[model samples]
Target: MSTLSTSLFYGGLGILVVGLLLPGWDTATLPRRAVKRRIYWGATLVALPVLFAAGWPDVQSSLAFTAMACVLMGGWAYFRTPNIKVGGRIITADPSHREPDPTPRGGGRP
Candidate 1:
């Protein structure tokens, strides 16, 4: 029971941390950044006390769970980051419905 709750708390924490550190999150405008800043800080303020209150009775499991969560979430998020190659040319090929004729129409078998 305790392990489950601790694991859930840790998992949520892991997701939040990975989302914070992941690139492209800060690509917002000033107003949008301000709103997100507020929300991020606001969630931290609200969550810490609640988590402390819940985990204070079982410190060991909470810490261990949080550690495992960090490792798992961090690795997952790392691999999921955009793999754009700088200065690389991107070619999008359109699939042809019909194959091209083997020989040209007028110039064939002349």
Candidate 2:
């Protein structure tokens, strides 16, 4: 494999494993959201080069790229997708949620 391909493959794999282990790690506490974000970005960063390689016009490069991409994307899609929690009840709404209306009944507010 080319240097880029090897780097992407190994880097992605390393990030994936670290992300998996982060929850159980006792060194420091990482919030669920933060953990998810780290894993997402890490996996994405690792896969970018692989994706680029897979899309290359050259056959050998494409094969290597595809392999790396598959590994990274597969792991990312499987593990990372479900961990992302959005719009949960704990997420506070904007201040506008409690604010009174500023506009007049029919015309623009002064």
Provide the overall lDDT of each model, using Cα atoms, as 2-decimal numbers.
Answer: 0.43, 0.49
For model 2, give the RMSD to the true fold.
Answer: 13.1
lDDT of each residue in 1-110, candidate 2, tens digit only:
66765665566556555655554211134444444545665665665565555345566765665576566655654444443334532222333222332233334331
Segments in model 1 whose C-alpha atoms lie over 4 Å from true places: 11-15, 18-30, 58-110
Model 2 TM-score relative to the real fold: 0.36
Error of 1 at 14 (Å): 5.2
How do the predictions measure up, each by TM-score?
0.34, 0.36
Error of 1 at 29 (Å): 13
**Which digits, one per residue and each the tens of the lDDT, describe model 1 over residues 35-78?**
34344444444445444544556787556554554555444433
Q: Please tell me which predicted candidate would have the highest lDDT against the true structure.
A: 2
The lDDT, on a scale of 0 to 1, for candidate 2 is: 0.49
